[model samples]
Target chain A: MHNIKIVLIQTFHPGNIGAAARAMKNMGLSNLVLVNPVDFPSDEATSRAGQATDVLENATVVSSLEEAVQDCQLVIGTSARDRTITLPALTSQQCGEKLVAEQQSGKVAVIFGRERMGLHNSDLKQCHFQLNIDANPEYPVLNISQAIQIVCYEVFKAGQKQYEPQIEAYPLNDDLNRFYDHLESSLTGSGFIKPSHPGQAIEHLRALFKRARPTSKELQILRGMLSSFDKE
Target chain B: MHNIKIVLIQTFHPGNIGAAARAMKNMGLSNLVLVNPVDFPSDEATSRAGQATDVLENATVVSSLEEAVQDCQLVIGTSARDRTITLPALTSQQCGEKLVAEQQSGKVAVIFGRERMGLHNSDLKQCHFQLNIDANPEYPVLNISQAIQIVCYEVFKAGQKQYEPQIEAYPLNDDLNRFYDHLESSLTGSGFIKPSHPGQAIEHLRALFKRARPTSKELQILRGMLSSFDKE
Candidate 1:
């Protein structure tokens, strides 16, 4: 099984946190990261966790989404609502397969947003891809824990390793973010993206790089090229 | 899409029923049938259903599994436990594909058992095959509604219909049950199976017939043969 982490952001109900823990543990996933949860160590969460309270006890609480998935090589955001800016979208099954294949290299994080609003545009921008659980067109808003269950179930299915293939290790989210920062500064310094009117160019660049998923060595080479541009 | 029915047999939790309804609606499956559910029209179930109250409102409540699936051509039972009397087992994906392909003929019922105990052996006997949702071997017991969600999701995925063959209509569960009764009594009358020592003969016969899945016309022909033996 892959070392998969379940990240819940700004969760309102502690019960959902507990239920999500149970869902993760039900699929052999242990790591649970919470970003700005409303309540922790609540009776409701503990009670809802049933026999899987250990998952809650050991869960990491972080202040931001970056901290939650900083060390992860692959970050996937679950979105219930359609966004104007399209990220590379994959069904839950595809996400699972990709996550499993990628897990051979490093850690992977599947992030879920708030109970009511789901993942914000800013949060989704940090993800390599968005996962949409193919739900009813009429009532697409699935419960957070239920969504967790679906994703975890898919991962567990893929964990059987029937489609296992060794793939190249992608850089961690932290490395990717750093590269994005370098790329942005280099673009501004090179007068490619005017500081005064960058427009949506940076956003488009981020999406393009996310899709490309440059490896660590590739990122280093790109950074060296940016350094050459900076010196010029 | 297949005309799929989600059946909950002897369900103890009204909230689960409501959640199951929401799960079904989330997957574009509306038909809900309850076989002796402990509570219906309860606040918990309605609250859990969220925006899918129409599913609950239109759900069919029945006294027995026979009544619940009598009109259905394909009856599949979901089981977590492996039984000594082995029935053809299919993962949720295979079951989904088969159900979707079989949907061209008639109604299909995917029955879920009680919350704590799951389906009784007698209940499993009624199904043509068993559907198992792959989960953690350490904790394979998924919540009732969660199981419903997984199965419904697979069916929804299979609903895309890559394999749409128009198969001949098979007899309903009611007709099949009636034929089994007729065959049993006729066997006793013909001295083939004595009422005193029937043993597992009827069960073996049931498994045989379930696999054979005789069509309505074939059932009528078999019934006629039994009637002739009765006259002799």
Candidate 2:
């Protein structure tokens, strides 16, 4: 999440740059470096950025991809097309995981190529590995912004997974069973489940509750509801 | 793949429609059904579609979710928010796998809701399950097109899994059904489940087996064990 820069090499559209910034911001990523963008500080870029002008305002503009990514310890070049060279190609997910793992060591850069031509083989040579997004084989090209959104999403997900909060334990089987018993009697009293045909109704109710795997608190609430229903 | 349909309900932006079409095409999916799109055939949509005009051109326009998915056997709704009623929630990956497995049985529809307001409670009721995309918790509000890209990518990946060598096949629904039937009858015959009150016992066993998701070979072994129990 920190010390990670997104480098756009030879970007042709100001709108894409803005959209890329917006995408990065959506994933809680802020650092952006533009290499030889056709236009900077344009109205179109700002308008597309919507409320994410801070990212656009803070973006660093550089002359070349090398200059933009020089500080990065890990450089990943994104390519839509397959190349003749046998460089290790990683999916967007794999790239994100690798970036998160290596981010603590130093700065990491995910470099996106130009709109039409993408990154040249020479530019790709600077990368340790190529990141290839698995897209529809029929029309595999993704908008630059769309690609950024996906890659940033992966990185964000990886970081989030590392800090995922532990969930409370599910209710024990005995608690669930007791809740079910209370529910059955309440429903039968309410005429929702006829005494003679309660077996099928109770089974379906059990199935529904089992699928939910409610927490201990939720089970208590459900039992309370049944008691209220019984009183009614 | 042939019978899968992407249903967009009340899409607000024409540009998002175009982007979604591009995303679908990028993943080798073309069946697009729009339910009450704000604007179609707009210049912005076409422009965003880039080379994916075929998907946009051949897209079907429907009035309601019922109409769009009436013929489909499996309907999956995508929801960013958790609901009060617990539906069987599947991750994008799991949704893809289930869709692929059931595609041969009938048409499968993956429905996306509007930009600002997602599908209503009634709309969700029509779905067999819900697909929740893992996104940045800070900004989980993904652009509609970005969600489409992630989902289509998952489906494409699941399709690719069939050709991926050495992975044992998961038991198909039909195979699981046969195994469940055998299990129930054997349990009844073995006195584990009393014949008169077998409903709840069979339902619990079914739930347990479904959660286990035994592979094809494992199903066969279970059926063999049931046969042995029947003999005893």
Candidate 3:
């Protein structure tokens, strides 16, 4: 993740730079390259960064986006999907996965443009792919840090593709059946269910519980409460 | 879509509320609810909200999480996995799919807790599930608004999937709350709840019912059944 650079071009809001740094750090990416930011080393950026001031402190400031990503094997620029500039585009998910997969081989970058106007044509040309974040066409423009956030989140997920399998323990059929039986008997005792006329109420409850797929501990709690009700 | 609510609880930063509004709007989510914010109607929030100031303007301010999501059927809280509270959990992807699929039936919510402390145990109990955005374990915390960005992105993607709702519309939070109230009263009448010594029993039941997420018709049956118990 460190090999991938988050390059921002002439960012007008220092807070965005700070937010972007925080976004990158939260996702485990540390390389930050700023291309002629309007303001750098500002208190606003530092204040917005929360705990990620280290990323900003270590940032590499360059004169141009070209110079920032010059040594990178791949560069992905973010833009609205319907922009006039035409280029091979990667969705934010694709950008994240690709960067994580390919970052080890060489330096890589995912660049973001200025706040109001996105990347210029020249900036887009320097990229191997334009990254399109999924959004409503009516208002596709995303705040710069928010755009970085989506991209960074994707990268984080892709990098952890082999995350440890879930360790949650679900109830066995016997316990679940016991729970259902206890539930039915208790409800019958409480007059919530009648003995002779079983209807769809239990079925609906069953279906809803089935979808939830309770863990073993949760099932125990359910059974324990029902047993207490029976004692009453 | 319009039925989805983005609820923020007691946010200390007004800028975050604004950024959250922008994040929600960027992904076509409009509903924003604030539960006892430290500051609102501030220039900082509006300035940060960008063109999404309308979302902030139309935001609902409530005193409690219970009030904020009273009308929502399914409520999801955003939190790290290592919290003291436990609930049925969903990844950001699943949270998106579930909310989109079930939203047509009743209002749904995705909640964010305070910036420093995250959601409280009381808050977690109100939720059927918790949303954990994948991130570096060493530093999994994301800016409140940035987390909103990722969740909304997944939601936007899921919406684009053009999913057909297979499940029946669920009951509104108001009806669900009423059913709970009736259940609690009936249980108390049955000596199921000791007034001086209420423990995890009711909360666990609330969590269970929330997980089941009964439909309006199903809730009616449950409530009707509870009424019978009261009569008995």
By DockQ, the better pick of 1 and 3 is 3
**Candidate 3 lDDT tens digits, A109-178:** 9999988888888898899898989998878899999999899988988887575688878878998888
Q: Which lDDT tens digits does candidate 2 get at residues A127-160?
A: 9989999887667789998899878878876777
Clashing pairs in 2: A136-B26, A136-B27
Comparing 1 with 2 on TM-score, the higher-scoring candidate is 1
Better of 2 and 3 by lDDT: 3
- Tens-place lDDT per residue, model 1, B72-175, is 88889999899887689999999888888888888988999998899999898779999888877777778888889889889889886454385557788998
Scored by TM-score, the top model is 3
Model 1 DockQ vs. reference: 0.14
The full ranking of all candidates by DockQ, starting with the best, is 3, 2, 1
Chain A TM-scores, per candidate, are 0.95, 0.83, 0.86
Two-way lDDT contest, 1 vs 3, winner: 3
**Model 2 agreement with the true structure over B76-149: per-residue lDDT tens digits:** 89998977553566888788787777776568889999988988876875566788877655556667887888
List chain B TM-scores, each candidate: 0.68, 0.70, 0.90
Candidates 1 and 2, the one with greater DockQ:
2
Best by lDDT: 3
DockQ, candidate 3, vs. native dimer = 0.60
Deviation in Å, model 3, residue B129 alpha carbon? 2.0
lDDT of each: 0.82, 0.77, 0.85
